[model samples]
Target: MSKLPLDPDVADVAPTDSALTPYDNQHIVTYARLLQAESEGADWREVARIVLHIDPDHEPDRAQNAYLSHLARAKWVTGQGRLLRGAGSN
Candidate 1:
């Protein structure tokens, strides 16, 4: 995968910066949409393709893997895709 084009602002993380939060709202929404598609038996690779359209230089494999891991954990606890749906509902 090609490297993402760095945003100089984002590249600099101060000790007290709030930008390091693990769950970015936009990222969360993307992950949730991907998860929902997967739950409906949609091809994850296809979802990844669509996601990469927004951030083409993103590491698609990593993003997909993270979303899958999150979905699996949520499924184990909730037995449904509600959490994934909720994440993107806003």
Candidate 2:
């Protein structure tokens, strides 16, 4: 793996695919944060702003869509790939 930005710019819409996309590789850290926030039961709105850098208050649809899509991808990756999963998940 190449050097990944810990804080990459998020897209308003994430690529939808069963297979991982280049965006997914670049945003692994973002996925980790999203998963962490989800595990903590953090508000989606708060996670959108803090982790995704999207202000939900300003753009409800965009924020929600991005948040949901990215989070789904994060979970999918955790299931499909071992990169983000904790050792215990195995």
Note the Cα lDDT for every prediction shown. Answer: 0.42, 0.84
Instruction: Report lDDT (Cα) of residue 72, candidate 1.
Output: 48
Prediction RMSDs, each to the true structure: 10.5, 3.7
| Model 1 residue 60 distance off true place after TM-score fit, in angstroms | 8.0
lDDT of 1 by residue, 38-72 (tens): 77887656654554332214665564654455444
lDDT of 2 at 30: 90
Write the residue-wise lDDT of candidate 2 on 10-84 in tens digits.
999887886777788788789899999999999999999998899999999999999999888888888876445
**lDDT for residue 66 in candidate 2, whole number 0-100:** 98
Clashing pairs in 2: none
Worst 10 residues of 2 by lDDT: 81-90
What ranges in model 1 sit over 4 Å off?
1-23, 54-90
Positional deviation of 71 in candidate 2, in angstroms?
0.4
